[model samples]
Target: MGAARVTRRGFLLGGAALLALPGTALAATAPEIADCAAWGARPNSRVVNVVVQRPVKILVHHTATPNVTDLSRGAADALARGIQNFHMDRRGWLDSGQHFTISRGGFVLEGRHRSLEALRNGRKQVEGAHCTGQNLVSIGIENEGTYMDTEPTGVLWDRLREMCAYICGQYGIAPTEIYGHRDFKDTLCPGDVLYGMLPRLRGEVGGMLGQRLEGSSVRAASWPVLREDDRGPVVEAAQRLLRGAGRTEVAVDGTFSAAMAESVRVFQAEHATEEVNGIIGGESWPLLAAPVQAGDGGEAAEAVETLAATSSTRPPSRVGPEQWQQLLTAAR
Candidate 1:
């Protein structure tokens, strides 16, 4: 709606001004990106939220589109336009939900409208809807194709590594900070094959950035985000913890309701400084929960058993040796 906002990296002048200017070397090193206009996106009618803080992490997603044989640039452009249409018309988003996308043909394209300009400047970020809770604070890159079983083509892999390196370098994010969609949500998105490659992806990105990630950082964990209207065994697990924390109003029935929300607020009030929004995340999760194991009993054991009964595909749903403590602290 307005002239491209001036950025700290210099007057953007235009896209062709990517040559490394004095004091703007980092800005010049951004990977080539086709902006929304290049792919014929609709006019973004809604306000796009911008943040001054650099994103702390990169999230990888797969389009879940069929693994088609067409690897042409035209197909990539068409894919971008199709995604934008679906996001705006079907999903009711302002524009595309993700910050960027990489086609199977290795064409890197900007998803959200201003993402390319922001990435070039590296001082601002476009808040996205790519992931539920962490969208405002992280960059999401959707790689085209469902990698549930098959590996991505070598060209696509090379482009992914380059794009990740550029984003990490510009944002000052650690290579180990890269993660898959499933890390924050309870979905098989990005597929098992792609999700499994995250550690190796991190290591390779680290190599490109000259930063070696240790095994611990490589194995870093983030708990699932339980939002409104969502239901699962994990919700039941959290409900048990809420009951132990003295919010008896929360029913351990594997459903997220207003009562469970109220209980979550009270729990946060007691153990955390977070806003009483009833959302459970890293900040409150560790503070409310302690450690639970196979021998552990009481509400904590029941919580673990409930989560353990969740889908067998998810490793966390299993009551393994290192069962995350969900109710021990509250039960105390």
Candidate 2:
């Protein structure tokens, strides 16, 4: 099959350029997707307390269960209801745990009503509870069926790819931005088989956006001097960017490790224009940084501005000095 082509302008609009047969293939803004009305409305829905002062970075998730079934709009609605119940009744969340839900039949349902609203306006708002601290910058998406028992269906793959491309384009997130839930937490939420598609998924999304591979999103940013307090901000930023860049293997715990080192190596090798010494040196640091550039013709610049302002005004309450040191050492 021929590769998909995505335009930078289209990416900025959160649109995807998908290729494939009409029935089997789908694009991000595909009209086939049912509206919120398709899925029953949340009874007594109330606004949540959490404040999202920024846009989303990565889309995290799970398989929900191993119950694979035929793709249908009804099945998708059922999954949405189940999700609403689980999040509200069990998790004590105001709404569903994810921003979107993909049924076995490839039906995509919006979880939080405001989620789509946020995406549409281009304002960076937090989605739902996928990762703990990182949830502030990530959007959680749950896919039906455990890929372990059976491979994801063509519908699911096509839909997921389209959605990923859409989200990436909308937020100026490179294909490297999409991720599995396990990438941040210490759990197998997305399952092994599905997680395995992470790399290729990112590449496919990038292809749709017409962007070359940006390589691993994780790893340490190179800094010549590691001040005691520098680790927290720098490492957290790197972890977030790596996930957004589609290097979903690293944890955002602020601890740099061998895996991070490996990611740095891979990123450098892929870029070719940089040194592949596994160091987040000054030269490599800027490239690894997200929000692209201040004046670049991309959404990355706007995101960078948002992140800088947010981080400066409010420090991440979770990261610690020890974690920062580990991250600094690993990147070096």
Best by TM-score: 1
Encode model 2's per-residue lDDT on 32-140: one tens digit a residue: 4444566885752566434545444665466557665556677778878887888788878877767777787887777766666565444456447656656668767
User: Candidate 1 on 162-228: residue-level lDDT in tens?
Assistant: 8887777667777788988766654567887897788888887776655657775665545555656
- lDDT for model 1 comes to 0.73
Any runs in candidate 1 off by more than 4 Å, and if so which?
1-29, 222-296, 302-332
What is the C-alpha local distance difference test score of each model?
A: 0.73, 0.57
Error of 2 at 131 (Å): 2.1
RMSD versus native structure for model 2? 15.2
In model 2, state the lDDT of residue 61.
64
